[model samples]
Each structure stands twice: as C-alpha cells, then as structure tokens.
Target: ADSLSCVRILRKMRERVSESISKMKADMSRAEEQARREYERERRHEYDSAAYLISMNKQSAEKSKAALPHLLTMSDHLGVDLLHLSGSALSTVFDMKEMSSLKS
Candidate 1:
C-alpha cells in the first residue's frame, strides 16, 4: 500500500510538471505572437513613412521643374541671356543671388 501511494505521488508530480511545461510553452507562444505583431506594425509604419517621403520628393521635384520656364522668362525680361553668360563670373554671381532670394 505504501508502494502504491508512492507510485500515485510520483504520477501526480509528473502530471503537475507536465502542466507547468505546457503553461510555459503557451506563454512563450503568446509572447512570440505579440512580438511578431509589434514588429509587423513597426515595419508597416516605416514603409508608410518612406512612401510618403518619396511622394513628397516627387512633388517637390515636379514643382521645381515647372518653375524653370518661369525663371527663364524672367531672365529674358531682364535681358540676361543664359547662352551669352554661360561662362561669365557676373552670370554666376547673379544666379546665386537670384536663387538665394527665391529661397527667402
């Protein structure tokens, strides 16, 4: 009878150990899932930010290009021919001043 009780105790201990192991495994799986979800959310946010930046850069490039014709017209009105001033120091000076003023 004592041997039987010992056997039963051993079995109960094994059962408890098994239950603890299973609980630990479940906890680990839940932690992994949460980590995966958080990583995915961060990746999506980074992708969205990158896409927005790309779109903004494209828009800015288009705007800059579009303004070129107006700049050329203004230079013509000022009697400054780019072709004639292609290698002139005065032309470079004027161009720099114009660009600085435009930024301001």
Candidate 2:
C-alpha cells in the first residue's frame, strides 16, 4: 500500500510540472504578441509622418511652379524699363554736347 501511494504522489507531481510548463508557454506567447503589436504601431506612426512630409513638399513645389510665370513677366517688364531709361539718359548727354559746341 505504501508503494502504491508513492506512485500516485509521483504521478501528481508530474501533472503539476506539466501544468506549470503550459502556463509559462502561454505567458511567453502573450508577451511576444504584445511586442509585435507595439512594433507595428511604431512603424505605422513613422509611415504617417513621412507621408505628411511628402505631401507638404509636393504642395510647396506646386506653389513654386505656379509663381514662375509671374516672376518671369515682372522681370521682362523691369528689363524694358531699364533700357528706356538708359536711352533717355544718353539722348540728354548728346544734346548737352551739341549745345556746348554751338556756344564755342
């Protein structure tokens, strides 16, 4: 009867050990899943930030493109005005030289 009790005790110990191992495996699986979720969240945040920056850059480029024709038109007008002013100044100088020659 004592040997039979010892066998039963051994079987109960084995069962407890098996239960502990299963519980540990479940805990490890939960931890791994939590870690994977956190990693995916971080990656999603990074992707969103990058996408926003790209969108802003695209808008800035389009604004610059839109301004180019107006800037070119203003530049052309300034060039024509400068040439007209230069011609007027040259004509005044020539008239002054002619008057001085006639007085002499």
Q: Which digits, one per residue and each the tens of the lDDT, describe model 2 over residues 17-82? A: 444334433543454455446546556646676655555444334433433343234336433221
Measured over all alpha carbons after superposition, the RMSD of each candidate to the real structure, in angstroms, is 35.3, 44.2
* Candidate maximizing lDDT: 1
What C-alpha lDDT does candidate 2 achieve relative to the native structure? 0.40
- Best candidate according to TM-score: 1
The local distance difference test score of each candidate is: 0.43, 0.40
Residue 40's C-alpha lDDT in candidate 2?
Answer: 62
Residue 58 error, candidate 2, Å: 0.5
Tell me the lDDT of model 1 at 45: 45
Off by over 4 Å in 2: 1-47, 80-104
